[model samples]
Target chain A: PSASAEAEARAHQTQLTKPAGSLGRLESLAVAFAGFQGCVKPTLERIVIRVFAADHGIAAQGTSAYPQEVTAQMLANFCHGGAAVSVLAGLLDADFRAVNLGCVGKVAPHKNLIDNTIASATADFSSAPAMTAERLSAALNAGFAQAQQGDLFIGGEMGIGNTTSAAALLAALFHLAPEAITGKGTGIDEATLARKTQLIGKALKLHRDQLTNPAAILQRLGGFEIAALVGAYIGSAQQGVPVLVDGFISTAAAAIAVALQPTLAPWLLYAHLSNESGHKLALNKLNAQPILALDMRLGEGSGAALAAGVVRQALALHNTMATFADAGVSHAD
Target chain B: PSASAEAEARAHQTQLTKPAGSLGRLESLAVAFAGFQGCVKPTLERIVIRVFAADHGIAAQGTSAYPQEVTAQMLANFCHGGAAVSVLAGLLDADFRAVNLGCVGKVAPHKNLIDNTIASATADFSSAPAMTAERLSAALNAGFAQAQQGDLFIGGEMGIGNTTSAAALLAALFHLAPEAITGKGTGIDEATLARKTQLIGKALKLHRDQLTNPAAILQRLGGFEIAALVGAYIGSAQQGVPVLVDGFISTAAAAIAVALQPTLAPWLLYAHLSNESGHKLALNKLNAQPILALDMRLGEGSGAALAAGVVRQALALHNTMATFADAGVSHAD
Candidate 1:
């Protein structure tokens, strides 16, 4: 956050394992942090995967075909590292951690529960609902502290009907119409699309008064998880650690992070392009092209995890390959 | 070829740099030569790129407008190892020695002469003009002796208006109409195509009496190089070494080899698909898929050299990467 820290991040970038320009965009990410840390081989000693999960009260509206139980089931899977992101972090040799930033029903504190309760899901953020300013700041701090142990961190999200909440937030914050951004989150039929659209329309009008910049928008209409992702990115960047950004809902969190601290944008790696309509918009806003394009639409950081292979290959090519001169052969000279 | 020598060839493939079935096709190739020399690592001691060149006496007939000198110049480049095939063989650590099997005018021999003129070129084969039996047998003997030192061999071609010869070969050999197999050889225009088609029609009529099987086909109408490739394939198979088949023209040689000795099919590794239309037809007839598809159209064993990379990677993946059980990772079952 300080000018000195920003300068430190830039200095570290020049000292990474490969040449200055070879790794392409990956170089940009490592350098942004290196300048902050001011060291070569700035070890990514830990890789905390921050999962912000919550229950959406909008499930009562029947907007999602999936039962709300899937969210908590996935959250439990996250805790056990049985989810796709868990497998990915293990492959990348990064640390795996989760947080129940906010959830509904009778909740018990699980291991590594970074931040708990802010009351379920904020009344759907569609009717008379939004998080208070105090609750929002607390969520942000909880995720930040958890990520501080890692050299870099990856942010993941899980929640049924979270897409509905994200759509509302995007509309209220960016002042975009629902149709331009709204897309089928998970096999929504035409009838469900109309229903979701109308719901977003209503949520935007109610939250319009509270809508300001990203910080105010999150405090009013954001979830406990959204605020935490913003904090995770900032915390990771502040410590000179890069963050692997996942899809759609994670992109929404990324947009919020960027809006809050425009400087944190350099620390982010756009893992993969999702088939989700909002993901393209978010990627376009961020100006990122993902590595793989298998037409995947799943969102538990699976795309990001797949991209780890591409990034690893990029690093290997940059570092291991002998140049034409090194091989003592003329390279089409 | 003695019965015992042939039996020895049948007994084993050659020993490669790695384990059996490790490099898959490549491993099979490296070992198949064991029968050739009756040794484990059947060394390719007698290396010769049977560069069967001819002036497509049809060129003198004005079927091709380019001066016959272009073919000689290209042949010079091939022998100098400055062409693409030379660079590729260098990558694979292969010895690419050339033989001037045939070409227009006189090719004076210094030291590296394998076989010289087998007639300036086959008569256009359009007016009872084809190779005499004595000349065809001499070319075959030269190819066999040149390849006999070790079973492994590669054939390259550089003959202006040779595509016309190839089309006639394909038509007579496969019993097809000229239009069914004709293509833009050496980037000829439509007017040239019309003249070429008519020229082929005349060759078909003239060679109609010699449209027998593979041997008669060679003696009656095929060029010195095509005959040499046929001899080379059979010669290698007889010696018990695997042969790396190049492109369409070579594929034609392979088809003729198959027609001669059916067992030779297993010894052939179809390297890469060529952009030549005839190559696709030939590959389809042979029931093969090439290893790579970089849109190669030249015929100098370039495709085979490139396919070596795929073979190496496949071998590495099969032999090096730790399996799920080996790594102590849980399997899906």
Candidate 2:
């Protein structure tokens, strides 16, 4: 991000016919784009959206409302343009793809589906580490390879029991109570929610010594898609592209990414606060202010895709609006 | 709004790809549009954006940050495609127009400018009624004439001291303390806010007898542009077009319109919560939940124009996204 370009954009906002700061956060959003693009006026003509799908072995404990096969099913749904993120990405004219990071069920080949399977599924974390260190590296490299240069990058996750993995990882990383971060992903019953919480608590106890750092925590409790998301975040930042982090699971990936590389913090922008119970807590840990809060918990990068429109509009306004001198408008008294 | 269509839309939502209610407020938004358009799936292809610009007599009391002449200047800006709403409307491909309800300064004619001048300006409301009953009727009729059949209707306002008028109207209508509703308009200083508050309190007392009804209250305290907005809101509802209400001043118009005809409430959807202090309180009075909260205080229907994009996306997803059965995806267990 260019500080000089940001300063120029901030000064330019004051001359855009409206009263200073009247456009509120939008004014800042435009300036942020200007900084990211290293120009006084930035355009968001290219948006790249990637959704990584895998299966969580924790689902073997009946942790999720849906069966693990749904992960592979949704990846097909994503490629066939039936998933929420697929619909939104099409609307946005974004470069959209689904990365198959090892789902339990078979996924058919499609133009939008990337075959990057690291394993059939992670090991159950309640008793064993979710993945070996080598598998974690494979998943991270798979995600890192997916990142390409674009105006904006959005990483989405699709896995049946990924939220359970996210909860356990976040609890261990942030030193939080498992109950504080556990939530009903894909809508679970009260008893299931209790069981899910207890499972995460037990996993935290199991991986206590190994949870010394972000990478160790992810390798112990994270799903392939989560690690891939973490890789994508770092990769996007490394490529000088801004990332719009999605809901709970995506945010968990972001926390891990930012924890590993603190400088990656400024390159990330939060998309929305979800209905997930611990999204706010996770976001607060990163001091993130999400752009939208519509109670959406469906994570296929849908939230980020919706916010892409807003970012586009903000840039459009910044680049197209006439200055006070150009519009012949009176300045404030 | 059609109850049957809304029911059908809700049912249709549950059958789509994602989990039930995973889309959050967007699901409800699509359902509402379905009800408004009387279809199971609604599409927003035509958007009409009208910005009413006038001068407030209250500006003479030194309540605003900008000169009264800036209203006419912004009217010109709106037509010339330079203002915030103008930029947004262009981006949304909306049919945009600026109606001159009465400005202190002369406004040049343009293809998109409507000459609906009710008077040079409203009378100084601190000393007398803002408009005569006849002039209020004229302003209302002008706004009513602007309402046309479109997929969506958005009403915007531009008056130098309109926030003072809005605060006064809301305080009197809701019977709240002057301090509770008064806010800094167009970025006024601390002293000006206090003065604005005191002046509104005084006007409420002076017009106590005449403020018995919505029409009377509007005639006594509202700007011409505000009256037109009220008329437009009612007119849009009558034409079976849903109205997306803009910021503080626009919400005041909605309140008056809803007060005159309670049925008009369902026809109106709030665009965004403004930086203005009284907006939330005003929205609460009508049970309105705005779609965006970017802290925008620039009222030219800018917020509504920005939200038009969101509404369009919502409808597009509703009308076009493939259903679960269509994609052969499994439902939750």
Candidate 3:
């Protein structure tokens, strides 16, 4: 945990003008950054946001409000710098890229779109496993290779009906009811939400016996983008880079990643608590308190991008604020 | 509210890439800004932070951890750009000014220091009223005159024993116990906290008969800085400029301001939920949900400075992002 650096940062925090621990989460965030960077003063200059896009076969069950083809189209929008995440990336001046792991339709090639298609689409998990073991390994490797050296890494997802897959996976892993972990994705109506829950329940029942390990669960009930996010999280931790986990889908992937490697928890920082119904449960499971609670459900690392600004502010405050001695301000009695 | 502008902003929100109500507080902030600016696309280009500094006579009763002299010393540090809020103002590129409403010690003249001293210090409210009616009017006038042509206004306070005054004022206004509203100020120990509580209880009992009016409450129990902050909040609303209310002590002032003008609620935006105990109750009384919950107890408008960045980002996204039709992205079914 870089105890020396953390100790140095804590001492520095105390020396600042404000009372000790008054900065709250910001203080803890600075200390965490110090431990991660292995230095007394941490900087958040370079940030990289990787979005993994894929199509979920569960869309055929009328689970999502949007069509499956919207996944590929949104990738085009992201490359054209017209999406919400694209604008946020520009606002934050962070590097952004989209990886097309799988899409139901033909995705037109773009300069920033990395072609790492494991399959056109996963099989409907309600009837069968989502992907084969080989496909899962390739997706994980592709995600692992996407990690680059940066001050912070953000892994997000773009997939139609992926929330159903995430809910199925979460329900199976936690041995909870589908209704307890399912929510309307992309603003689905009440009936669609019920059907989505039923679909997740069916998927969980179909693969309950086979979902013994993380990889097996990914193969049985996870989307390609979800699996890629898990790999990216683990890979970033292995490289000693802190990753900001985005909303519901990304947090589900984080759940899987942490289950695979419990030590990765320290390397993860949750960005925001989404308004999606199941996100609260997922965040509770991870024991995470997010930086923002903007109710942002758009999952292209947008929340992470906004949270990057908060982290930058934390670093700026930690590094720049004058000490009480330097400012000649009186200390507490 | 500007109905036309609010409608335009709401319609623009739906046309954006994210789902309806997904951006949550951000969307509401944008709409609020739009209504305030009387335009569809509002901006936060100019921000002015007004910090009111004073010394409380209640410090004689050992209510604060720091000496009353620290208020003047911190004012010097603020002018030299060494304080936390000073650094944050520099970071946010906002105009910063410190108004010495009242201070116990000699404060040197500085270019950025606004000398609006109503008195040398407020009287100890545990025994008597804090200020005369004439002094209260002068303090309010000084604060009301501080408002200028800025897109956003922030009211912060710097006083050693101001929390005690705030607690006493709150207890008198709400008819609650002093223990329900008292908290540790500047990192006080348990003994000091209890002493502060008892002092507040004494002040409330002393002012119980004369606390019928808001101005009466301020005159009896509020510090000079607190009264000025309340004036600034009302003045900002009267000027049609949005005010970002800071942490605990500032919130107490806000409560008094809101009580004076219920219509001013629409013009106020809460910045953060502070670590101070009474802050939550005050926020609940105002029916306000702060933008950030950073546990920051530093009350020199620091939280408001950080929240300005969020307001800026919201404006950026509100003004720049492409609509669904512009991006050729499919809409939800």
Fnat for each predicted structure, in order: 0.00, 0.75, 0.64
Candidate achieving higher DockQ, 1 or 3: 3
Model 3: runs farther than 4 Å from truth? none
How do the residues A214-260 of candidate 2 rate in per-residue lDDT, one tens digit apiece?
99999999999999999999999999999999999999999999999
Q: Best by lDDT, which number? A: 2
Q: What ranking emerges by DockQ with the best candidate at the front?
A: 2, 3, 1
Model 1: how far residue A156 lies from native, Å: 0.4
Tens-place lDDT per residue, model 1, B1-333, is: 233443443332111111112222433433344433445434443343456665666777665545675555455555554455555555445656556667765554534344556666776667755678888788777666656444346677667676677777777777878876665555566888888888887778877776777777766556777777788777877766566788767787787778777888877878767666667777887887665443455666655654543343332322333332333222211
If the candidates were sorted by their lDDT against the true structure, best first, what order would they fall in? 2, 3, 1
Across residues A1-333, which tens digit of lDDT does each residue of candidate 3 receive?
577999999999999887788778889999999999999999998888888999877788888888788898888888888777888888878888999998987778888799999888888888989999898898888899888788899987899999899888788777778899899778899998989898888777778789888778889999899999988998989988999999988988998999999999999999999888999998988899999988778888888888888888888889988889997888888
TM-score of chain A of 3: 0.98
Clashing pairs in 3: none
- Angstrom error of the Cα, residue B133, model 2: value is 0.5
- Candidate number 1, chain A TM-score: 0.84
The TM-score of candidate 3 is: 0.98
CA displacement after TM-score superposition, residue B203 of candidate 2 (Å): 0.5
Using TM-score as the measure, name the better of candidate 1 and candidate 3. Answer: 3
In model 2, which runs have C-alpha deviations exceeding 4 angstroms?
Answer: none
lDDT of 3 by residue, B1-333 (tens): 687899999999999877787777889899989999999999998899988999988889988888888899888888888777887888788989999997988789999899998788988888988999998998888898898888999888899988888888788777788888889877899988988888887777777788998989999998888888888888989889999999988888888898898899899899999889988998887788999988889899989988988998888888887778887778887
lDDT: the better of candidates 1 and 2: 2
Per-model DockQ against the true two-chain complex: 0.03, 0.80, 0.72
